[model samples]
Target: MAPVALIACFPCRHSKRRCDKSLPTCQLCIRKGVDCCYPKRRAQKYIVLPESNGVTKDTVPTGNDSSINRAGGSNRSSEWDQQSPLEVSYATPSVIQSFGTATAIQFIAPSIFREAFLEIPRINIAIPSEVAAHTGEFDQIRDISATFFSQVVIWTPVIFRKNFFNIALNPLSPRRTEGILLSLCMKLYCTPAAQDHRDGRTALYKATKQFYCEVEAAGIMSVCILQSAILIAIYEIGHAIYPAAYLTVGACARYGIALGLDKLLVDLTGENNAGRPWMEVEEMRRVWWGILILDRFLNLTNPLRGLTTKDPEYDDYLPVDDWTFLNATAKPQDNLKISAAFNLKMGVFTRLAQATYLVNQALKFVSSLPPPSDSDTVDIGKDTAQLRRTIWALISVTKTEFDAHDLATCCQTAISYCAILLLQDCHWRRVRISSTEDAYKHMFAESECVLQNLALLAICLRKDAEEGKSLGEEFPVFLMQIVYQGALTTIEMGQGSPNEEIQERVAQYKWLLQHLQSRWRVAGIYLSILQSKEAIMASIA
Candidate 1:
């Protein structure tokens, strides 16, 4: 067969979406339930006419082809055409040769290198140069970079501080686009730009998002691009930017897949990893884990939505301490270590990974349970019961260790409690709980556990609040979802019995939600849900 031809359906053309150009229908069109049609006029769009003059009557397809003028004889088409090749693999034969006989891949044939590493294809894009357009802007860039690292680093420690600064400080440095985009992100987030647009997105947000889209559209797959996109997704989530936030995570999922960051990581193994530095591999692992964390946290409450990032495998390595990882010298992996297990000595990120794992396991366990119906009893299954016990035990211990721990830990503990409550609540509904006083008491205890954990989150947040700090600023935005669930659960338990303790807990949940709204707009969404529930409860009371 001849090389496949690329064409965009009219719908994709109008909507400004990527056209996979699949026969019958493109994926985006299929998603939107729209007709996919390729107009014959576009055939003339790509037809190349030989040029003896200053301009050629030819056009090349790109993300934004309207900007391309055929009369200008723009040679950009050849550079950006879909078939253009990108040199994505870092370890080439020449680079490996420098490591001498010590490098495992040095002696291996080039064919083996081709087989081991997949090169991501390239599409050329015009990187937005707002931050880098001037020589004098480096000082502002450095100043803005300070705001993101301190607390946001705890949420996802994917971007190394020194690497970011080196690229950021030296605007003319290699990988200039990465530096530019990162600087743009820092500037926007430092003193968040006012939402001047009617759509509620700031000018800075639009610029950063535009830069992100252009890079993604042009098939630029790098950790820098992924980190920028992930940061944008976090911003969307915190401010309750829907559909965009949801779609951004999905986009990052695709980007991570393209980078081969999530699965069958060849660079991480001791056998074939070859001459790549250990920190490089660690960065790879951290990026993958970061995706997993974001995906889980985004859908922690609504398991039905499923996960965008890959599920953590049995042999996956958890990150070492953030402090050590950031500051320490390179250590050769030469071995795959650190399975997903708990240790008190581990960093906050590791605890987050472990806690997130519990949530994922709970979701999987719940899937095994039969759907709810008019049944007196439901089988918990042997394996699932074992899993539930493990989750409960972990939550209990975290609860015991919860003294003066940071908000992230409290977020972890709170979510873990939410996870078990989710598992148990599905099979053991309120009607079933009232089946016996003991049953009711058991259910009540579980709610109280989750409620107290949520309350502790509020209390922990208050310290920062007392110091005139932003509530939920350092924590993941999906903590808003977990807090909402806590408030909802407290109300339900209170309705079951008008207990003073439950009511006091209800007040604490409200206060937490109220304070959290200062930092995360998603809190306002959940707070409204709580109000509606309270109104219904009052009428029924």
Candidate 2:
């Protein structure tokens, strides 16, 4: 009989080397001064008795099939398969208990969709032979990368500007993650709708995927890797490819969680190493918030789908002002100087994040309430009144903080208006058409306020783009959806009176949508509605 194979020491097994099976410490582990551990013998394989007839035979649980052990096989669906929101408990069990059983649902990038993410095959397209000039290609990528940092990075401010340039500036140094980020950025800049740049988009996408797989397989985790994923997610969102974005951001969130980014390390006692810059801590916080923003926005865009990050725990403050971020060189301490201007600018997104969380909570609460019959009108009114109070309170808080004439203010106001719209959206449409005096009166006032908010948003967008101060129609994809919502509201309101200013505003939206329609499908829908409404108005005149 063949001699039984010796089980290797843990160190040797981990290093994939031979072990002599010596006592105390193996020779190799002793030489390396590493601890030597031995694994327990595997349990004898046994058959699992079927609980019912016609069930397939199951094997004893093993390390490779731990998931199967939990589910009793690969076939059973968990809570995720039902498309339910993930209820993330607080990191501290004590805190969670004290916070009450509010049951917040964070849209985590569910593992149920892991198969779909893995299905994005590794692409390996080569660069064109004609463009094989190494120096030329390098310069071109750097230029596109600059465009990405300046234009695209604004939408997802998780990436640290200085660090990105370090890799981008030195093209000769082999950096796979940076290369993938550059390629994705190039693709976003040269989307298919750009007509002249369409060919480059596909090439960039293939190259990005190729490099991403290679880097991912190497098991690398760093800020650059996380930033690359965020950029790719943003690029996917710009093209309205949500599932792909969801997958990318989901992976990004996993990486962030693995890095413990949700909590500020600086806040933890003695965790900061001597040389670790305050910026590193800030970077983690920014990346965490960026992930949260995308997670909430993704769910907001498609309420039907399960969320990407569940009840995310964030104890960090909102990002500091741009002036402080861009200018400060010294290590920052507690009480970092904040810029009112920058706060005014970012307040919309900050409040939007909070509103989204509230919305999720509200959704959970609403779902739990017993369904009411038509005769049970009192219960429905109570629920509606409670929701309205919550929404108005949120609006009051947001409005009080930043009340400027900028896009941020306009966006927040629109969101507050949307809260009211959300409650009565279905009936509001009916109210607009109803002959009842009370219904018409209510619809007219709400519709007018909504249109004014949208008009301000449109003007802000138009003015910013026209003056070349904006991202050239590459505005936040979600914001574009809001603008489109405003357009629909404009159409509904304009059915009664098509005044010159309203007509002019509609024309401006039409002009803006023409530029955005390629990247955002909602813009295309808005353009169609605006054009159709114009045609109808013309026919009536």
Q: Using TM-score as the measure, which candidate wins?
A: 1
Worst 10 residues of 1 by lDDT: 64-73
Error of 1 at 214 (Å): 1.2
- State which candidate has the highest lDDT: 1
Q: Which stretches of candidate 1 lie over 4 Å from their true place?
A: 1-136, 187-200, 264-267, 270-273, 330-340, 376-385, 392-402, 408-411, 430-440, 444-447, 459-473, 537-541
Please, what are the lDDT tens digits per residue for candidate 1 over residues 104-185?
A: 3213443332332212122234444453442126565666666666555444367766667655564323444565576676
Q: Write the per-residue lDDT of candidate 2 for residues 1-541, one digit (tens) a residue.
A: 3233357655565457988887766889789866565554533222232222334432221111101001112232222121111111112332222111111111133232121111111111233322233213445656666665555224434555665555445432233234434445444444544445432245555556556665555343456667667766766665555467788888888887655565542343112222345665566566676777677556543344666565533333555444455444423443221212223444344555455545554444443444444543333334566565655556656565543234432344444455445444434443333322433344534445556656766666667668777444445565565565566555544564566765776776677677666665546655776678657745654
Q: CA lDDT, every prediction?
A: 0.57, 0.48
TM-score of 2: 0.57
Candidate 1, 171: how far from true, in Å?
Answer: 4.2
